[model samples]
Target chain A: MISMHLTYDAQKVYMKVLEECLKASSIEYELNGWSEVKLKGQPALSEIRTFKNKLREAGIYVIENSRHELIQRTKDTISEMILHQEDLKSPKLSTYLTEKLNYSYTYLSKIFSEHTHYSIEHFVILKKIDYAKKLLLESRLSLTQISYKLGYSSVGHLSKQFKKTTGMTPTAFYNIIQKRNRTL
Target chain B: MIRGFLKLAVVEDDKSSKKLFQKAINESTLVAGMIFFQQSNELLEYIDGPQNHVPDIIFLKLDPMVKNFLKDLRQVRKQHQLRNTLIVIYSSGASEQLIEDTFVYGANVYMDKPHTYEKFREVVEKILKINFQYLESNLNIENFIYRT
Candidate 1:
């Protein structure tokens, strides 16, 4: 059984993906968790490959191993945090993840990089920039307000990161959007 | 910046209409920032310049005389930056064909511009009250083209 409590929508999406995978493979399986399954008989490599492909086609992540699953959870947690504009002062990301997952940051970082080919810090930066982009075009907040909302140290810090990631200043990006909106 | 404010941009050529529109927007607490353009070209130019501040929502007034303007607007909307912004078409003499065309061209709302300032303010307030992001996440694109 899946241990974590999921909303109705989340459960529906997960169940659909699970049902699809089960249908693709003839072997019976025991559900250990939402993403974990135990096959009754030793399934052939071909059968597993087919099931994986079906899940991918349905836009679901194929968890190869426990490490991969942990990485995915980390990513999901970080994204949700950034999307909600969670305050930075509460706890550092590493500390929060460590406490939430009950794993040391060192172990988490090592596994994350090994599986995802990106550092946890780098992934956080990318997610923050993506969130910033949406906030810029969708909200009336100024750069200063946006910086604080995203938990950047300051407006200057946010600008530097934004420029480094996007190859242009936030103002420039805004201008491009503005120009696009008025073209007609 | 004021919290919970909506940034608005107005693109219209009629002087009286522009004045009324600005007055209505200014009267609303939801409006944090606003910019006006007499011609679509002026708005385009402002956006192209280095000092661009993208608005969250745009109030676009369509003129019947400017056949090329609609075509130009469609072309402008093709850019990536404008993808997230909501485009609301404000028109007085919209034919059924033009309304259909506007929806096809990716407008989110089709509003008949009211003559009275009071009515205009009410319409603007109603539009602002809508949480566009929430509506978008629902993924029902068909209902996006709201008419008034």
Candidate 2:
């Protein structure tokens, strides 16, 4: 669930309208909210179809089975922290997530991996690199300054990974994109 | 027929699925009312507004009740007096009791999206047809009730 805050009225509107429609159609559902709640995995297949029809009526966008849940969650965490304060590093990221969400690092890691097929640490690295990509494309920061800003120990380390993932060195990417923009 | 556009709202969390839904809806000439929200709160806000841009339907790809989703609905019931905002809860799976609880908390539609897009389109068509009839009769009764 995307969680920041939710008003009571929205929740009521969802539950009330959804309940009335599905019951009439005799299609069972878990209206309370959980994208991972799979009706086919639990209910009969034909019934699931009828139920889905009812949802379309309500304009309730239902997401079937999937694991982008974790990806979105982590993005929210990153965006929130970065928006509020800058200069956080990955060394402390695991601990921060653990503390903020109140789950053991092990449990979060396991669930995230099982669902997403990506290790939590790798996901974090990807996010940090993503942040670096934004800065490189959008900001005037020097590579050394960006390395320090992203908590990389040094510019060489940042360059090695940046080139590996993006297929261009930071300077090369910046110049290339800039030139492309000029042409446009 | 309302004969303008089919107003629709999609509330799903998965990015790939959401993209597909948007693409499908955009390509379809049948849908006139198309809006998208990734989370519940945004959809809820639209439902609660003064003009209440209530989509003719709302598609809620519910997440697990990690935070008491039922409670959220009950709160809305108390606050908005919102009526007829069709809510469809689509998930991959659920239990018998959980399914029952969907009604207990108030869901108008419940669907489990299948693997095939053909089946998906079939499902969308069927519901649109049914609701078109249902809404027509429903408006009459609602008018009778409200007038009294």
- lDDT of each model, Cα atoms only? 0.70, 0.57
Residues A1-184, candidate 2, lDDT per residue (tens digit)? Answer: 7768755787678767766766676544453352333332334434555667777877976563333455446546755554333445453767777777766778777776544434666555555555676777778888888888877779999898776543456765555445434432
lDDT of 2 at B83: 56
Residue B52 Cα positional deviation in candidate 1, in Å, after optimal superposition: 2.7
Top candidate on lDDT is: 1
Please, what are the lDDT tens digits per residue for candidate 1 over residues A1-184?
Answer: 7699655787877888788778767978888867667777655545666877887787777655676568668877887777666455655888888888899999999987654445788768766776787778889999899998988879999999987654457876565546535533
Shift in Å, residue B47, candidate 2: 3.5
After superposing candidate 2 on the true structure, give the runs of residues whose Cα lies further than 4 Å from its correct spot: A1-184, B1-4, B49-51, B75-81, B139-148
Candidate 1 lDDT tens digits, B1-148: 1123567778987889878987887676555678888776777777777987677777888877787856866865654656666778888888977765665566666688887889989877766644233222222322233456
Candidate number with greatest TM-score? 1
TM-score of each: 0.43, 0.38
Cα interface RMSD of each candidate: 17.5, 26.7
